[model samples]
Target: MRVLIVDDSKAIFMMVSQMLEEKGHVGIWAEDGVKAVEYLQENSDVDVILLDWNMPNMNGPEFLEKNLTDSFTKTPIIMMTTENKPDYIKKALSLGAVEYIMKPFTNDILFNKFELVDEIA
Candidate 1:
């Protein structure tokens, strides 16, 4: 699957990319939500998106609004953030997020989540 990691932190991008790669998933990088949107525009084949909560050009929620309203790309979004409040989770899901992963997640956890997601879908 073509997975896009949109985050300001390079370390997080590298970690997540490496984890997904280990699971035989191709990973793509975007520094912020703005670039992520452009990436989706150029590579509409992307199956999943991992978006961080905080970014420079546009935040996760802001980017999601555009994706929800824009006609181009409305692919599934998986939020990755440190925020663990129920309200935040509810908000992201309300905005059409398919899943939410807390910060500092390991490859094993991610793999398990993916497995469950696949089964549920």
Candidate 2:
């Protein structure tokens, strides 16, 4: 699986990338939603997106809203963020996110979410 990780923190990206790599998956980093969009425009092979709610230039919700009409809309998105509020999760789902993962998650949690995404997709 090729996962597009949209997060502002390099550390988070590194950690997640390592976790994905352990499972023989590739991780692509995008510092923010703007960059993610740009990357998607050129690469439609992304299997899923692990999006952060807060970021510079563009946020996860903004990205989801913007991509609603784009070709990559078919790509499943999992909102990975510190925002644990039910409202936030609901909003993300309403906007088009297929799943949600709170920050500070373990590798198991991340991969389990991926499995769920796979089932859904």
Candidate 3:
């Protein structure tokens, strides 16, 4: 699987990419939503997106609002954020995120979440 990782933190991206690599999935990262959008424009074959709520230039929700249309409507977007607020989670789901992953997560937690997305997809 090819996963798009959108986060501002280099550590987060590295951690997630390493985990995905261990799972035999390829990970492509973008520092923020703007770069993510640009990457998506060139690589629409990505299997899923791991999105961060807070980012510079373009946030997760704004990214969803801008790109979740036409061919991208049903693409799976999983929110990987430090924001634990129920309202925020609800808002992200309402905006088309398939699931939410809180920060400080373990590889097992991330793998389990990925399994869920795979099942649905």
What order do you get sorting by TM-score, best first?
2, 1, 3
Q: What is the C-alpha lDDT of each candidate?
A: 0.85, 0.92, 0.87
lDDT per residue, candidate 3, 62-92, as tens digits? 9888875634435689998888999999999
Q: Between which residue pairs do clashes occur in model 1?
A: none
RMSD of 3: 1.6
Q: How many backbone clashes does candidate 3 have?
A: 0
- Residue-by-residue lDDT tens digits, candidate 2, 1-119: 89999999999999999999998999999999999989988888899999999999999889998988765557899998888899999999999999999999999999899899999
Pick out the ten consecutive residues of candidate 1 with the lowest summed lDDT.
Answer: 112-121
What is the number of backbone collisions in each predicted candidate, taken in the order shown? 0, 0, 0
- For model 1, the local distance difference test gives 0.85
Q: How accurate is candidate 2 locally (lDDT)?
A: 0.92
